[model samples]
Every structure is written in C-alpha cells, then in structure tokens.
Target: MLTTGNDTVLSKRATKTANTDEFLLTQFEKAEANLFHAKDNPEGIVNMGTAVNRVMEVELIERLTKPDALRFEQRYMHYFNNSGLLELRQAVADTLTRHLAPDNPVSPDNLAIMNGAGSCLDALAYTLCDPGDVVLTPTPVYTRIFTDIEERGQVDVMPIVCKAVPDNAEESFRLYKETVEDKILETQSAGRRVRALILVNPNNPLGDIYPPGLLLDIMKICAKYAIHFISNELYSLSIFDEDANFQSVLSFKDIPDPERTHFIWSMSKDFALAGFRTGVIHTCSSSVMKCLGKIALYQCTPSLIQHASATLLSDKAWCDDFYLKINRQRLRDRYSCCLARFRGAGITVRKAKAGLFIWFDLGPYLRSRTKEDEMDLFQEILKRGVYIVPGTQLYCEEPGWFRASFAVSEVELEEGLKRIQQVVEERKQKGQVSWSTY
Candidate 1:
C-alpha cells in the first residue's frame, strides 16, 4: 500500500492536475485569478476568453428562476437517483425528440442526466476507455476536453491535424472523413486501440457547423471501426447564421450504429445556465446506459437543479419562441459587431457561424511565427486589460491563432475590442507584419 501523506503520494491521475493548464491559469501571479468576480475587485478584468452565452441574462434568469420553477413538493427529496429523475430525463428526451427526431420518439429510458457536459464526458471516458486507450479529436478544440477525458480516464487525446485553407472562400482547418479513418488506421498500426472519436458540432474556437452529410460520413467511419462516436452538440440551438445548417446526429434517418453513437448536451451553452450544472447523455445501447448510470452517481446534478431544468425544458413554446429565438438573434448581432470591428481594423478573423467565439489569425502581430511569440503577444494584450485564449492553449498545431468570445455585454465587448485595437496598433507601429508563410 502507498503512503497517503501529502499530494506527492497521490494517484497519478491526481498528480496530473498539478501540471494542467487549468492549474497554471489559477496560479497566475500577475493578478488574482478571480479577477472576473464583480464583488471585492474594483478593477474589472475584461473577460473575452470565457466560452459562455452572456448575451441575455435577465431573460434567462426570469425564465429559469420563477416562483413555479422548483416543485415545492420536491423540497424534501433526499434520495439519490444515479441516472437522474425520470421526469427530467423525459423532459430532455421530449425536447431532443421535438428538435432533432420528430419522426422517431426519443425514449427517456435511453438518456442519462448528469451535472454539466464536462462531467458527462468524464463519465463517458471512464465508461468506454481504459488507461492507455486513445480518443481522437480535432485541433484547437475546447481545452477542457483534455482535462475531462484524460485527467482521470487516462485516455490519450490525439489531435487530427487540419491544414489551414489559404483561400478566404474555403473553411479553415477543415476536417475530412478520409483523414479521420486514416488517422484511426495509423493509430491502430502503432499498436494503440482507438476507442473513441469526439466531434464538437458548432465547434468551439472555430464556431463552424458541420454539414449533415459530413456528420453521417464520420459516423459511418466510426461504425466501420466499431469505435465510440461522441457527438457534443452543446451549441445545437445557438446557431447565429441563417444560411448555416445545423444537424444533430439524432437527425439521421438511419443511425449507422445506435449502440456506438452517443451525444451530449448541456444547459451551460444553449440555455446560458452554466450555474445550473445540468447535462444529458443520450445513447441507444442499454449496456452503455448501464455503465454510465453506475458512474453517474459520482457526477450527478442536484435533484433541485434537475427539477428546475426539467420545468424549463418542458416549456417548449417559451424555449422556441422567446429564449432560443432571442438568444440566436443576440448571438448574431454580437458576432456581426465583432466581425465588423475586426475587419475594420484589418484583422483577418476566420468567419464564424455559430457558437460563442471567433478563431482569429493574430499571425500579423507575432514577432516570429512561434508559440513563444504567441505567448508574448498574449501577455501584451492581457496587460492592455483584455483576456483572450491563445491557440497554443487549445492545442492548435500552428501558433498566432487566437480564440476570442464575442458573447459579452456590449460595453464589455467594445472595451475588449478597443484594447485589442490598441495592441494591434502598437504591434504594427513596431513593424510586426503578417507572417503568412508560417
């Protein structure tokens, strides 16, 4: 038996968190890490890095926290439901069915509700992967996927590198179906089992939606290899572009392998209720559902939250007409505002259609086409009173790309844009030119 003294004797998984980017960010010495807290800190940190829907708070709050929100009869609830309340699960199932699978009814029995999507991913990771199993995902993804899937699960997350499209007309860092299969085959040849592939629809950082055909092709590839395909449609209803088509994996008429295909969604992104901490996992495999149910005990959302979320989701008319519609319009307006500002400043921002952020090329500002230069630029902007996540942190192959959230209050967004403009001007005056060759 190992001596359980200090953290030095902790499990390897626990020790891994010590060196994680989350840990490093919390330990930043320049300022208190809780700079975003409104209370004690009079000096506000302009947060353009956090991936959240900060567009409409009053409406969401009013809608979710009304007097009838929580069933008062449920106040005495003290028992644990590992798979969550059937009512909540039913609500989610109904909502999903209404949105993505109107033809086929989504059974509540096939769903498992947990605390937020991050925890759901963590549970799924353990349910499917072993200590050395591999999970493939695209580059410049939401960084937390690494922490959620690998920290405890001990899964190796390999990036499927995508080359940047030189032409403005083409999408950047495009994910090809063939490349995914090739990568899986390559990983197998190297003697590691590819247990899973993660697809973030309306992708984080990129904010682009995958066409339905592409999603089906990818699902077929996963089906062929008998690997788990985890589709995180967290921002499914957050589509801001009128022309962009957003298709949930459930929208497929014929699922390639219902047992292998799974999906995750959360109130955190779509409903702008990260505080509620509600996540749902839908799987057709009864065995997978059993595995998830067993593990979900450790990651269950509170009964109160579950009840409240159920009440919120069950109101389909309000969600469709008021909340989702308003949310999309706000996101569109904010995205347009940010896009116009960047273009006005001659910054080449990859056009985004959905999600809360824009992947912008800061190659022009980097002193050299290097990660170090990227960090230098990042630090300079942070000092100028704005926070944006550098692409290096998101595991992008190339440096000088940055993920910036346009989902902020108008005042805050303008302030952040001003600070960014200042930094860009400062860099330009100092002779920093676009290193397109990188």
Candidate 2:
C-alpha cells in the first residue's frame, strides 16, 4: 500500500518519495487529458464542469481599462514585501468590510494576501493541522478543497455525510449544528484530532448559502472543541438572490472563538479574475497571521497583479454600483435561464439562490445505482458533446447527482442543455430510464 493508503503499485524509486505527490499528479494530469479543452473544442464540446465566470466579459474588460487601472511602480521589482503589498491589503480590507463586515470592520493588519484561495487553504492546513489530524467539511464540496488541503498538508478530510432522503423538498443535505458536533465527536473517538472545520458559504457546486444562525451554531461547536474555523467566503458577493440573506463570518459581532476563526476570499469567483490569482486570508488569530506572513513568501501574488487588483478594489463607486450590481444581475439571469432549460426538459434541480452552478439528479438516466453507472452517464453526456462533473468527483454520498456550471455564454449554455435533452430523450426512448433501482 502507498503512504497515502492508495492501492497503486509502486516501484522502488517511488518508495523514496511520497506517494501522495504521485497520486495528485496523476489525478491532475487525468483531468487535463480527459476534460474538454475550451479553445480546442470551442465548437465541439460544451464545458459545464469548471466553476468559473466565463460570462460577462464586457464588464470585466471595462473594469480593467487604462484610465482607471494602476501602473506598476519601478520599485515593485525589489523584494520589499512578500506578504502582500500594503496598499492592496488595505484595499481588500476596505472592500470586504464595506460589503461583508460592516459592523465589525476588518483591519489590514489581520489580512494576508496570496496567489489564490487554494494556496491560502493549503498554507492554512499546514499551519493548523499536524500530520494525520482530521479536518471536517460537508459534501459534496468544491473538489479542489480535497487536493488543496490534503496533498501538501497531509491532513485527512472526514466528510460530514449529509444524505439525500426521499423527501427532497426539505433540502435533505442541509448542514445542522447537531450533525456537525456528532461528526466531530465521532472523529475524536476514533483517535484522530479534529483540527478545524471548513465551511464554504454561498457553497460551490451546490450554490446554497447558509443562514447566519446556522453559521454561528457551527462556530460555537468549533469553539467548544478549541479547533480552528476556516470559512471560505469566495462566493459571498456572487449571490444573485434578492432574499438569500447571505452573512459573512466577519459580520458576526460576537464570535465564539475569535482567535481560532479565519476567513478566505478571492477575486476568482466574484470578480471573474481566476487567471489573476488574487486571494486574501483574514484572521482574528495573531499567531495565524504571523504564520501566514511567513508562509505567504512562497505563495505571494505578482506585484503588478496586486497593484492592479488594489486599484480595482479601491474604486468604491465602480465596485459597488456598476461592477458588483451588474455581475450579480447577470449571474441571476444566467442561473434562472439555465434552471428553466433543465425544468423544460422535465429535469428537477435543487433550487439555487447563489453561486454559478446547478445541482440536478440524473438518477432516472442512470443504468444502475452505482458509481460505474454514474460514470457511464457522465461519459454518455460527454459523448453528446456536453461536459459536466459527476457527483462522485465532489465526494457526494449519493450517486447520479451532477453539478453543471451555468456561468457560460448563453450560446454555450443552450447548446449544453440541448445536448443533455437529446441524450435524455434518446435514453428514455431506448428504455434506459431506471429510477426503479433508485
């Protein structure tokens, strides 16, 4: 067996290094090899698997224009700062405070900037968790969360499995405080130290937001155990629902454990700047801030990108009035259109109020209630020229559920949906609809 407990056969040379590295390299290469390449398959395949804002190019271009954008200073080439540019940190602090933490303002001193949220999570996991320590999260989550923390941190992720019951109307996968506590206790009893609890508010893949009350309850549990609480609010501003009532952990006036709480945000999702790779880490823990200051040296964003991002965030009028408002409206419109397309095809999707994707069940389209059947369905969709992520990839407890990002152009979204409809209709006609096994 490999060190990471994988069943892969290893050579003598492979035994010299960590097996987890090889495992992750293989998984990443596989994704690159099998997944649709947008440029190459522009007309051939519809990529709905990646969670990104491929839409709204006009707004993005407008924001990064010459007159408004920042120019890099000659001094930026030197190594005066590696944690982050102070100006950029302040800008991020001010922007996040204005939107997500008005009551409890975030201080620039408490912020650590990095290349991306994935790097921040990796650094955080390394800082907080010892080898073999467990971190708990609810699934199905953004699949990268697993690789981000586990590959380098070597921490075990124990899923707080939320089942999808027959009564799906009540949102069976919703996380509860009691369930979180139970999972923590269960992990502890099995001789593992639960180091932290990570919550992705305005959750990815699911696109659901947790209420403030539930967030507080979960925070209290983490407090009781004296463990860290890492809240990835990358999608906080992406909420399209007028009534979703999204709350940031920074907004909470009274935190259960101030020192153990940390929050992460990024320009990737809300600002459609994934390529820019700007991520922020806000912590109440001074120790964490200090540790991050050290770790950030290895994961710092480019000085020029940091300057440009700072200029963008510092534009209060543009950020609040034009960019954010228009982005949210666009997301709402696209998500609504996508949902309508699914419903029009007699498919049921979990009603989403935030984020960029839809979670829908394809159990009826599966040949059997197994991972093999799920992959078969996934492959069939790919064969139909549409690419979507199967639930199995996201560590979903149940099979036949898939996440399809609607953050593509209307042309792409419609093409993908049409492919799905054609595939389903043909399968049904061929008597392949097998919900009987479900």
Candidate 3:
C-alpha cells in the first residue's frame, strides 16, 4: 500500500502526485470558500493570491456580448479541426504579428491552440522530453509550473535559483547567462540530461522584462547545448511602464535555434479573460508541431469559444484602438495605488514594470528569517481574512518574501491591505523581531 504525506492511501501511480507539496491549491480553496463582496459579504476573505485582473470585467462583458461577438453557427456544433479553428489561429497570428513581431510575421500553420498556458506547457513537456529528463527555469516563478511539467509527463523541473542581493533589491532574482550555463553544466555533470530552458518574460511576481541582448546571449547558449528554449510571453500586452522595453522572442529575426525555440501566449492575463481557456503556442519546428497535433484532441478548446475569441482578437479597431490602450492605463493606475498602499504600510516592495502582482518583503514582521516563520505570518494574515502567496511555494530559496495581486477592484484592494496592515501592527505590538535585528 502507498500513502501520500497526508496519509491518504492511493495507488503507486496516483501517489506520485498525491505526495507532492501543492499547498497553493489548498490555500486557494480556503480563499474561494469565503470570497469578499462589497455589499454581499464585506467580512469575507479577500483573495490577493490569484493572478487575475478583474478591472476590465465590465469592458470584456460589453464587448463579448455584442451581436457578432459570439454568434452560433451549425458548423460549430459538429467536429471541426481538433488542433484549432483556422479562423482563430489566423486571428492569433495576425494579432501577434501586429503586437509582438513586426519584422517576422507569425504564420497560422505553426500554432497549436490549447485550453490555457498550463496545457501548452504540459504538451510541450510531453513532446520535448522523455521521462526523467530535466527542464530548467529560474525561481521564484509561478509555482504551478512544477506540477504542470511533472504531474503526468513524469518530467522533473530543475530550478536555477536566483537570490536577492541586499544592496540591489531592484536587480534581485535577475537571471544571468553565466548562471544559466553553469547550472546546465552542473546538471549534466550529475548525469542528468537537460532538455529545455523556460524563460518567462515580463515575469510573474518579479514583473521585470529581460533585455534583448541578454535574451540573445541565452538563446545562443541553448543553441550551443542543443537544448530547447521556451519563451513564455503570457503577460505580453500587460506592460504598464512607459519605459519598459519588452521584446518578444517572436520579434527576433535571427534566433540562434529557431527550430528548437518555442513561444507561448494566452488571453488570460493580458485581456483579463482567464475564463476563456484559450492559449496559443508558436513553434517553427514541424516535428514538434506534428507531435502536438496528435495530442491536440485531448486539450482542444471548444469551437464556439474559439469563434468568440477570434471575433474579439480580429477586431483591430476595438483591440488596438480602445481596449488595449485603456487596459494599460487601468493597470498602471492600480499598480500605483497598490505600491503606495504597501509602502505606506511600512513594507518593502520590489518595483515591478509589468504583470498583475507585486513581490514584497514581509521580513520585518517575521520572528526569524525562515520559511516556517514566513508561513506563520502568512497564516496570521489569512486569519485576518486576506490571502497572499508565500515565496517558498514559488521555490524561492529565501524566506520572508510574498506575492499579492493588485488587479482586484479598488475597494477589495483597500480592504486586503488594511487587513495585512492590521496583522503587521499586531506582530509589532507583540515585539516581534524586525528585519534589522533578524
């Protein structure tokens, strides 16, 4: 008989996932059970942990419910393309060409549409690597990547742990070419094959974009090692900083390993359409595309939903002229408000240029600089009716760091911050050790 860490009996195959530490989902369940609403349940929990942008909900509803947006057709009710509708893929290609790659226009034939970014990653894992092969990604990242790659694919994620320097908090967790190569060599020396490297641009939690030169250098390294390079541009259209120089890998003309490089994007973050369950993958390799096609039936999006998505994406007037421009402004405003609130609460936050969340330090509130203490503070804040993710769950080697989304409504954001402030003040009054002393 096999059992997980919580002592639930299961088959050997099932125990593999059951034994893994997926605490984020557990916390999310708790948060969802008591979600806060302005008039309905003001005393309920405020979820700051999930990376969802709720600011554009009304706008999305308005556009999606229009006459031509989601019109039903008889053909849509029958089986069509299992990979994706040609209409939707072409629309995605056109949209990516306009925003991401001006020089190299994207081709619809190279794309594979899935339910979401998680499905894309899972499919890539299955196609690119065999069981027991390693995929490298820098930490602290979105924690779900671990299970996404490993759960059913039976692959392992090797973390290229990037530490935060005390003197340069702005450049904290920055991934360097040297560090990447070193980790690759180290993993090879251990007799493990490194099949791929994943780069999250306009990174989640950190929210910093990689410079083009660095990207080129890393791509060259992947070429040298004959490994796959995956560029996850999930937050491509969410850049709020006027000075942010975000260049998608799709924009690069001379990719060192074009055949081995892949790009991923989704409507979830940028368009505030997480419920849409639409994700796109663009790869130049025909072999990879062939492999993906065989599995597309298992992860394909509904034809009706694909039609609606195409309608929204193909409308250049609405998407480019109004929605995107207004969305960026709203994200900028919300980010500014959240940053000010955290700083005013006497907490230290890492300045971010993009993404829905902010990575801030709760070191001052910890009794000691340890993950246990970090989680203690997390539970205390949750008890006060606010839920935020602790950094340890994201494979952050250091303690006392946390990520919280500011994409909620203004009222919810204020209430969540107030609860956090109450927890901090309570800790301080009880004479907890500050960051300086710790």
The prediction achieving the highest lDDT against the true structure is 3
Off by over 4 Å in 3: 1-11, 18-21, 436-438
What is candidate 3's lDDT per residue for 313-400, written digit by digit as tens? 9999999989899888888998898889888888888899998988888887898879899998998899899999999888888788
Off by over 4 Å in 1: 1-8, 23-43, 74-76, 167-169
Model 2 lDDT-worst window of ten: 19-28
> In model 2, how large is the Cα lDDT of residue 236?
93
Worst 10 residues of 3 by lDDT: 429-438
Tens digit per residue, CA lDDT, model 2, 324-408 = 9988898899899988888788776888888889998887788886889988988888877777888878888788888898888
Whole-model lDDT, candidate 1?
0.85
Best of the two (1, 3) by lDDT: 3
For candidate 1, write residues 77-125 as lDDT tens digits. 6876699898789999888888777878788998998889999889899
Flag regions of model 2 displaced more than 4 Å.
Answer: 1-43, 67-70, 167-170
User: What C-alpha lDDT do the candidate models reach, one value each?
Assistant: 0.85, 0.84, 0.90
Evaluated against the true structure, the overall lDDT of model 2 is 0.84
